[model samples]
Target: MLLLKFFGANVDWTSSIHPSAKIEYPWNLKIGPLSSLGEKSWIYAMAPITIGEKTCIGKEAYLITGSHNISSNNFELITRPINIGDCCWLTTGVTILPGVEIGNYSVIAANSTVTKSVDSWSVMGGNPAKFIKKREIKNA
Candidate 1:
């Protein structure tokens, strides 16, 4: 992952990124200290993707920062930033869509698809992820 920094990715040296994780547009990617990207995860950073400190993205998670605008006759590509805040956990198979801001300390359940911004400390699940509960960090 150190090589990613050479390509303009703002990856912290303390971060643990699995070798199998695929990252596109490295220049647009930023990973904070002690964060992790699990094995086989894919990050399509057509815009910017910011993963905050101590966050964990589980295996096979997919983060997409671009999509086609079907409403346009030419099907133009639209790009947006994905911001995942501190201490968050995105479980296995979670799919985070474009322009979504997952707030600090949030938890995204397995296989959830987040289509919009999530509140801080929220536990969200299901497709187009809905708020299931608040994350209570003991002794935090």
Candidate 2:
């Protein structure tokens, strides 16, 4: 993060960004308020990655922005967008593949491979990641 500090990247408190984290194009990796990115996390950005307010990305989590073309016999590669909505928490070792959009107030369990879109207010786990349950908030 010395590069970010050197480049004058804006990081707000109530948020923790590890020193070992690698963010490709820190300018493009737009983080809203109260968000945190963990240590050794790699966020590869060809397309933009937008993390909404109060979100947390766990340690060593890989967010791949690039993908491959299935129709092409030569197996051409492509890039897909990733958008993580507000108040979400992504646990350690979670791999959020290309073109995945996770909605608000959701939690992805550790070591889960998210190949599909997860709905809002849901809890997901396992390989290829199925929905475990939904999150219910209590009104005060």
Candidate 3:
């Protein structure tokens, strides 16, 4: 079981978590059981990021839960929470922006940037992360 020693969050490792994973400034980062974060992944949760159970975060992925609103008069910084559902697979170099919620069992391709919510069982990719296709998986 992997334990995150820093930040104000608590992780229950009855689930599976890699020992070499890193979460910077995790004030309120919560990860469920049976989830695994690959090597060299960066979770920068300036706000809040909740990852569901059995989820697999690929190697070298970046989860940036901080942003700024350019339309504001003072160019104010805006922050939102990120929620990743269960059994999802995020490939390498995937970037999850603030306020994005990826549904359960979804697959995100490598080098994709998620700027919005993705439906369940959907396969997404590209710069803004459009829907590539939908996948139906049978229970094991």
What's the TM-score of every candidate structure? 0.97, 0.85, 0.87
lDDT of 2 by residue, 63-131 (tens): 888878889999987988889999999999899998899999999999998999999999999999999
lDDT of each: 0.97, 0.84, 0.84
**Model 1 misplacement above 4 A:** none
Top candidate (TM-score):
1
TM-score of 1: 0.97
When 1 and 3 are scored with lDDT, the better candidate is 1
RMSD of 1: 1.1
User: Cα lDDT of model 1 overall?
Assistant: 0.97
lDDT of 3 by residue, 18-48 (tens): 5666787766788888887887888888888
Worst 10-residue lDDT window for candidate 1 reads 131-140
Candidate 1 structure quality by residue, lDDT tens digits, 13-120:
999999999999999999999999999999999999999999999999999999999999999999999999999999999999999999999999999999999999
Model 3 clash pairs are none
